[model samples]
Every structure is written in C-alpha cells, then in structure tokens.
Target: MPVASPIPLAPVPPMIGGGEMGDLVRDTDWSSTALGDYSSWPASLRTALSLVLNTKGIAALYWGPQQWLLYNDAYGLALGDRHPAAFGRPMPEVLTDIAPVLSPQVAQVLATGDGFSIENLSMMMRRHGKEEETVWTYSFSPVQGESGGYEGVLLLASEMTQQVLADRKRDRAEHERAQALLRLSELNAGLEEEISRRTADRNRLWLLSADIMLRCTFDGVITAVNPAWTDLLGWQESELIGLSLFELIHPDDLAHTQQGASLSADGHAYARFDNRYRHKDGSYRWISWSTQPDEQQINAVGRDFTAERESASALAAAEEALRQSQKLEAIGQLTGGVAHDFNNLLTVIKSSTDLLKRPDLSSERRARYVSAIADTVERAAKVTSQLLAFARRQTLQPTVFAPAENLRALASMIKTLVGAEVELAMDIPEHSHFVIADPSQFDMAIVNMAVNARDAMVGQGRLIIRVGPARRGSEANEQPMMPGDQVVISMTDTGSGIAPLHLGKIFEPFFTTKGVGQGTGLGLSQVFGFAKQSGGEITVDSEVDQGTTFTLYLPQASEPREPRSVEAPHELVHGHGTGVLIVEDNPQVGAFAMHSLTDLGYRPVLAINGQEALAELARDASRFKVVFSDVVLPGMTGIELAHEIRRRYAGLPVVLTSGYSHVLAEKGTDGFELLHKPYSVEQLSRLLCGAMCTHFSRVT
Candidate 1:
C-alpha cells in the first residue's frame, strides 16, 4: 500500500457537531485506520486510503473466485467498449470476448507468481462496429496476496501490422525490374550483331567501286582513300600521306589544278575540268575531272581520257583526210573517163596510121611519120593503163599468199627505189599467214608504202615491215582482206612521221608533198583503193619526228593458195556457134563491137539501145545464144532489156556491162554477173564463150 498526503480540516458548526458527536469531533485523530465500527478512529484515515488507491491506478475487485483483471486507461482501451463496468464484475463477464484469449495466459500467470510476456501476439477483435485485425507485443502479470499466491492477471499490448506489409510489396517490384533487365540485355546483343554485319558490307562495297573515293577535311588533308585510288595511282597509303595534291598534277597543268582546287574550296565547284596527271613512271595521262563539294568536304572523280583524247585527235585528222580524198577521187574519175575515151580514139587513129605504113608508101619521111604516130599511140596506151590502175577500175586476179614473203620478194626492188643510204628492216614473222588479195596489188601496196617511207626518211632511215594478228573488235572475227583473213601488215618507219594535217589525206590521189616531177601522188590513192576493194582498213600512227606506223588489217586465208597465173592462148580462133546480140546507143561503139565479134568468128546482131535490143530479142529470141548489152542507154536500162529477154527466152544467157559498177554491186544477186565498161575484144569474146558454155551445161 502507498501513503497519502494529509489535509488539515476547519472546525465544524455547533448544530451539526452535537448531532454527530457520538462519531467524532471536528478535530478527531486523523491517524487512525478504522472507521464506521469504532468511534475512536479518525475520519482522516478513511480519506487517506481512498487517495492511495486512486494514485496507484489500483481498484478493488469483487469476484466470487480469482480471475483476470487490468488497470490504467491504456488497458481499458484494449478491451474496447464491451468491458465498461470492469471494477466489480467477474473477469469472464468483464471481458467476454477476451475469455478465450486470456485463458492460457491466466493459467500461466496463476501457476507462476512472476509476470509473463508474449511477443507478436495476434487477434481479431470487434471495435468501433467493425472487426480489427492487429499484431502486437503483449505482457500479462499476476497480482499477488500476502502469501504470494496468484490473485489475478494484468494485460498490456502494442500493435505492429503496417511495417511487415510494406516490405513484401517492395520485393515484388524488384523481381519485375530484374526480368526487364534480362530482356534489354538480349536486345543489346542482337543490335551488336546487326551493326557488325552492316559495317562489313559497307567496307566491301567501298573497295570494289571503280571510281576512286577520298574523304578529306576542308584544309585539303586526305583522311582516307578507297582501294581504287590506291590501285590506280600505284602508291601505298604511307607514300601518299602528307603529300600535297598539287604534286600529282603534271608540270604544265599544275597551275590549273591549283586554281580548280581553290575554286572548290571557296564553295564554288568547277563541275568539269581536264588536266594532265603524271603517272608513277613519269609518263603523263589526260584526266577529266568532276567534283561535288559541300560545306565540309569535296568529292572528286577523274576518268582517264588519254585514249579518248587520242581518238578525237585522230577523228579530226581523218575528217581532213576525207576532204582531200574526196578531191582526189573527183580528179581520178575525171581523168579516168577522159583517158578511157581518148584510148578508144587513139586506138582508131593508130590503126589508121598502121594502115598508112603499108608497103605501098616507100618514102622514108612518110614511114618515119607513121612510126612516130605508132610510138605516140603506144605511150598513150601506157598512160591510160596507169590512170586505170590509179582509179582502181582495173580488174585483179586475187589469190591467197603471205604478205611477209611477198614483201621479202620485193626487198630488192624497194632498195633500188629508196637508195643505198636507207636501211630496210623487216620484222615480218617467219610463220606463214595467208591473205586473199591480188598478188600484184599486194606487191604494189607494199612497194608504195616502202617508197613513201623512203621518201619520208629522205632515203636515210630504217623502214620496218611488221605482220601480226589484231583483234578487229571484241569478237574474235579475223581481219578481212578483199572480204576475208585477220592479219595486219604494219609498215613502220624511223623517218619523220606524217604531219597531223597530211596524215588523213596521205591516201588521196594527187595530194602530194613531193616536188612537181618527183611523185604522181597516185601511190597512196591506189593503195587506199586496193585496201577498200579488198575489204581491209588502214590506220596510221604518226608523231612529229618520232616515225610513222601504217597498220593494214587484212582477212587471213585458211590455206595457201597458188599464185594466179594465166597463159594466153596462141590461136585467135573465133567462136562460130556462139550467136551474140549487141546492145548499144552509139553507132561507132556498136560498129566496133560488131566488127570485133565478126573478126573473132562470132555471129552478132546489133541493136541501137535497150529498146532496140528488146525489140530484136522479142522478134527472134531463139536466134541469140547470148545478149551483150550496155547498161545506161538512151531508152531503158540494160537490166530491163535483160529481163525482157529473160521473159521471152528465160534460158538465154544474158551478160550485162556497165560503166557504174556501184549500181550492180549494191544489188544482191546469185544469178546475175556483171562486167564493167571498156572491155577489150578478147574479154568480150571470152566472156561470151564462158556465158554460153555455162548456159549450155546448165541446160544439159
């Protein structure tokens, strides 16, 4: 029990004091413990006991047997409103809901006089019209009597539910975060592989590109170069690094190259430019350049134009030569036509002169004049033959033979023409390469080239003839000479090369550099005509003071062909059975042909023109075995007359002659054969016999 403080009381009133005099006076003994049953006890003693109970939170409980109890405002709140009258009720009634909850606790406290404690005790209890679930720390203590036996149990508790729930929610969130992290790791790996693959592809593309690519800074320092750049320039990375780009330009083009670069750096690009670049071997190449520039860098691509430049230069030269060739062709045509007519006139004049030289005239003076006329006629004939050869109008007997051997055969003749000072060098291979062309024409072509080379060298330089195969194009087609073979006859000279101006016209007739009498200017023209007719091409390479190389591309022959050799027959026997019809516009020409046929023992009927020939053929088509007609007549053409003849007598052998061979050559035909104008008496007879014999054989 605890002691209490004493309070001093005032004196009571006389009327109230007398009535309660038997119990106590106003100032009774306050130290006494007993009241009610004994008058000697003080009233102060009762008040003292009440104060001690209230101060210690201890209340007196009235129960039939021992049970649990609690003290203090905190313990009352734990029981809630259900235990409102707790001081004198039974413990089970006071805490009806807590009876089960405190049964074990009460029993333990009763057995042990010492207090007991329970940690994390949980319970669901009703409070404030709802069930509250709570976890708490709790303690239960036993109240002891004087003998120390258990009297009741005291309860104390504390709630702790919020902290545990918070930790579990945090754990779930961390697990999800870990899963997302794993997914992100996989995605990163795939991205790495994709990036690596793209890098390799870009690198390969850069290396294979044909155009050189360079990445450089604005200051003109090259930072990188593609494989094409390194391969084309023939320089390694180390050798090119830190070298000024101007050093790559040729000495003559250095200023222009710098100007172009400067312009590009100033944000203005020169889209196209041409300059010379020095090769690694010190040789120069023409380069055409195009550039694309941006704020930070410039990209340039250059194409090698050396070949194209040379071709352009060659084409310009060829055009000039074409002009000269056209001029020469005009002259040759005029001279040839005049010479052909003059030869006919001379033939008649010379025949008359020969008749005048008969034995009847014995004067020396008259005989000398006749002999002089004959000499003049012979000279005139030689001149016409030369003109015909130069005009490329003469016929040729072509055969397959090696040009190298042919040139060797003419070595002595070429030496005589050039003079002893010039050294002749032959680079012709020993292996036989055959070409189909006239042997005489082939010889003449080589001799003419050698003569030109000799003249260009001033009779004191090396002249070389090289023969080999040259590809005509991408196809493996052989070079064609007179339309067949693939070999080139190259004539190179050590003398001064042809001038750029004259190189093209070098093949034109009468276009000469030689003094008046030194050359007829017909050599190269004849060579050109022979090559063109043989379906060959001639290309010339000449540099001032270096030398001239003339390459002749000819069709290669499959096998060696025997040289063309013909022996004239001794007898001039006429064809008596070969009946021929002559078609002509001019009476003189017609008479000449008729008489020539008559002398040759051929029965020939004459017609004035194609109309007359057609009329004659229509009258008696069976009488003519062959019809020899001139094409360009006064009325219809020779072809029309032949068609008319064929319509009447389809089996009749018709031979057509023309002055313009191009007209017939342009037409494709297997049955039609053509003979050009100015045929001799023998040609006419032979052709007639050949046509009649062929027709008879076919009929048989």
Candidate 2:
C-alpha cells in the first residue's frame, strides 16, 4: 500500500490568460467565498468561470447559490475605483447600487436556464468617490449545473455613459431650438396684422379726401382720380381716366401746363402752378395745382380759385372808377383857377384899352396905357404857357446840355427870386451831367422848385441844391426812376415841411396850399409833367416843422456836339418878290396868312387845304420859292404834304406852323423849319426869309 501512495495531479493551471486579472484570480482565496476552493469547484462552475475569464469583451461569472462575482480583466476596469476589491465578492455586495436591477434578470436567467440582454439600462452606482449616474448594455446567461440544474448567472457588459450623455444633450438642444422658432412665428403674425391695418387706413384717406387728388402718367394721361375731381370739374372719373390732362386745360394755359408736366417728367420732386381747366358745362375754372413725382407717375392736388380771381378783377375795376372820379374833380379845380386868374388879366387889359381910347391922352400917357395892355397880354401868354406845360402838351425842343453848367448860370436868378433873407448853397460835382430835355423847361422846373421852397420857408430859410449822377431804379431812390443813367437834382430847404395830408395832392393840377391869388397852383404840376415827359421822376421827403427835400431824377444823356455859333440879331429881312405858297384850312387864317406874306414883301398865294395847295403847285412847280403850310389840314396833313413836296419839287423849301400838333409832338419836324403859331410879324419875316434863302441856294 505504501507502493499505492496517491500520485498527485499537477496543480491545475489557470484556465484563461487575462494578464493581470488572470493572475489575480489565481492568487485569490476562493475558500472563504461561497464558490469555495477552486480545486474543489464543480466542473460546471469551473467551466463557466473559465469561459468568462477567457472572454475578450467585458465579462463576469456568478457561480453557486450566492452568485458570487468572478470577472475577467475587461470587466474589472468597468468597476472604476472598486476594481480589485469586487473581483470575487458576492454579486449583491459587489454591485450594491445596481443590485435591484440586476438581481431580477439574474434570477430569471438562473431559473429558466435562459440567456437575456438589456440595452441601455440606467443605474446609479458608487464606482468612483461618490455615487453617479451610469448607463450600460448587458447580457445575462444561466450557467448549467453538472447534474443539469442551473448553477449561477453569467454576464456580458458594455458601459454606455458617454454615448447616453451625448444623446441626451443633443435632445435638449433640439427642444430649445423648437421653442425659439415658435416665438418667431408668433411675432411674424403680429407684424402681418399691423401692415394690413395701415393699408386699410391709407385707403380710407384716399376715398375721403376733399381735395381733387389725381394720379397721372409722366405723359400727362390721367390714370386715377378721386371723387373731388367730379365735384370740382364736373367730369366723371371714368370719362377722364383715359384722357390726356392737357385736353382739359384751357388753351391759354396749355403752354404753362405742358412746361410743368415736362419738369415733373424730368425728375423734379415737386412743382406748383396755376392753370384753367375746362368744365363739363364748357366754361373754364382756374385751378391751382401742387404735384409731386413718384416712380413713373405724378400725384397732383388741385384747388379752385376762380372766385378769388373774380374778386380781384372787381376790386381793380372799382379802383379805376375812383381814379376817374378824382381826375374829374382835379379838372374842375383847374378850370376854376384858370377862370379867376384870366379875369384879373382881362380886367387890366380892359382898363388899359379904355384909357387909351381917351382922345385927350398925352403921348407919354398913351404909351403908358399901351405898355399896360402889352404887359397884361404878356401875363396872359405866360398863364397859357404854364397850363400847357402842366398838361404835358407843350412841344419840347430837347437838347443835350450839362445840368451843372445850367444850374451855375441860373444861380444869380435863383438868388434874386429866393431873396437875401434865405441863404443859398450848392453842391455840384465838377464832372458834367448832361440830359436830353428842353433847356428852358429845365430852367423853369428849377425856378418853380425854388419858389416852392422860398414859400415853404417864408423867405428866411436855407436852400441847398445838390447835383450828382445816379443810377435809375437804385435802392437809394425814394420813388422809382426811369431805367437809364440819371442826373439827380435835389433841392433841400430848411423850412416848414409839407403836411402829410396835402403831400399826395401837391402834383395834381390846381392843387396847392398857397393863399388864393398868391399862386396859380400850377408850379409843381408843371414840374411833375415836365419830369414825366422827359423820362424822369420827382420825389419829396419831409417832416412837419423840420424841413423838406425835393429830388428830381432826369435821364442822363451823352455829351452833345458843340452848338453852331449864333449870328447877332439883325434887322428883319424881306422876301422881296419870292413866291410863297400859304396852305391853311381856315378861311380867315388863310386870308391873314396871305396878307402877312404880302406885307413881308413876298408874292403870296393862298390855298384852303393841303390838296388845293398841292394842285396849285402842280400847275406851276417852279413858281413857288417856298411852301408854308398849317400842320392840321382838312385834307393832307402838313407832314404828309411836305413829304410829297420834297419828293415832287426837290429844290423847294417848306416851313410848318402849329400851336399844338400831334404829328409834331410824336414824329417831330422832319428836317423842316417849324414856326410856332401866333408868331409876331418880325418872326414871320425872319422865318420866310430864311426859307427863301435856302430855296435860292438849292436852285443855284
């Protein structure tokens, strides 16, 4: 039996090569565990352990009734911080955090001898320092006993904590994004409602507006119109929609309307103009329009102002009527002044004539009476000349003369008129100022102003006369001057100023503040008329009890050529049988003219009219040395007759006489000698002699 000593089998080698974990399994004390000793373990349990240990993925075995833990190297790492201590522990103690979830699956596998798997099972465990959430997929399989009863549970596991956490984070992001999209959708809906409301409001305004609002194309074709268009223009919208806007415009307004339309078409932002539009009843109404260009069309608003225009025209007519009434009043005053002044002159003449009629009158006494009559006649002629000047009817012989020189020449006369009581001062520029006006009238105007100043001063104030060049229409002028270079003649007086009430009427005929008989009321009026006729203006500035200044603006003229030297006055020459033709329409004037020419030593012929005179001349053209004709004739005018004579008888000279001839005033004497009416015998003689001399020279 000693020979029968049992041969001991070599210690059983580890069934798996799991590296470090396999070595740990060999070193582990399974004796204290429910699985007991490894050498004495059942084949079923041993085989299960071996299979789990050799598994490449994470795997573990729970053998025996206690279901103690036995794991491979891969399964050990899934334990985190509890690795080595949980290697051989009972499953309930080793995975206490997931025991409740894993116990049921393990029991089911053991009882049925079946295998099962769980995907993404969640659990809480203290694998590290503290308890944390974890996810895993697991497989459970029953290990069969040797005798065919289930022994314990086998497990395959994979940790899914990272994949599960990432999926959960992605799901949270998707949910928040969906909420933001919903809020955006709600805001868009509210914005859409606001836009609809505004559109409705604009439509209401378009329908309810009272003004005539219209839309037209750039070419002026009406595309749309509001109700006001019908109310104002009496045209239906349908009827006007396709019509050209220009067609409804009055003919006289078409050009302006077209111009405005063109400006709009050229991209002008806004335009305003007034034009007339034809109404349905065939009358035109004035329409003031304001338009704005937009895109390819024009938007316009129109208002009717016809009633306002009619009111303005009525006001103008009323003003003209008032002016005419005032003119009639001025004429009445003028006639009254003329009658009074003429009666005084006539009384003097009548007395002088009656005295001369006394047969016992001595030579010296007769001469004195005659002188009185002559003086009265001279006064009457002066009155007539002033009236003519005030009426702007006198024929003016305009010459270009320097105003400064003329004023200097008249200083002595002005001094005499103003009296020694008043001081006279002059401010005249050395540079010459020339004007084309009647030299005598200019002098008379200055004298009249001086007299007015003297009267205003009551013979004891200073008078300052200033002469300077000025520009017409300059801002410095108180009254508008004629458009040209002008010479300003200002007379400023330190005297009692004119009252505001009488200032406006000072230039009216027969309008004056002077005492009756002290003035004819024609002085300032003559100045006014002369200044106007010569293309000038006069202005007055005054303050009550202070002073007054009268400024006369006369158009300046270019310097004139030196005048011909005048021959000294000589004895009147006689015509000496020179043939003179007298053309007069009035019989008495014709006879008087014939006698006067005969007395002047000229052979005279008389004709009642221009036609008769022409006929007489045609009969014997060379028989007349000169033709003298009245300006106003029954047939051909003096100007027309003279034109004919010049063409027919080139060598003949003509002399015209007129008191007031429109032809002479407008057209002037056409290179012919003009003799004023009511001429003295010496004047007639001198003029006729000159005409005859000119005729003789031409013939020779």
Off by over 4 Å in 2: 1-202, 216-221, 238-240, 243-284, 292-298, 347-370, 426-433, 468-484, 557-561, 566-573, 586-591, 607-612, 632-637, 694-700
Model 1 over residues 97-167: C-alpha lDDT tens digits?
55678665677666776777777666776665677765667666555544546555555456554654455
Q: TM-score of model 1 relative to the true fold?
A: 0.43
**Model 2, position 200: C-alpha lDDT score:** 95
The CA lDDT at 305 in model 1 is 75
Q: Tell me the whole-model lDDT of each prediction, alpha carbons only.
A: 0.66, 0.83
Q: List the residue pairs that clash in candidate 2.
A: none
TM-score of each: 0.43, 0.63
Clash totals for all models, in order? 14, 0
lDDT of 2 by residue, 1-700 (tens): 0011132222336555667776666665555555556678888877787788788899998866667788898888888898877777778877888888877778778888889888998899887699988999988888788888998888988989999999999999898889889988988979889889989996787788777888999888999998887888899989999899999989999998888888899878555679999999999998887888987999888888999999999999999999999889877888888998999999989998888888899999999988988788777876776777777776677779988999999999999999999999999999998988888999999999999999999999899999988854466555563576788899999999999998898888777788776888888988987887787888898889999999988888998898877554343466678788988888888888888778878889988787888899989978887888999887689989999999988888899988777677667788888887767668877887777666665589
Please give me the total number of clashing residue pairs in predicted model 2. 0
Best by lDDT: 2
Q: Among these predicted structures, which one has the highest TM-score?
A: 2
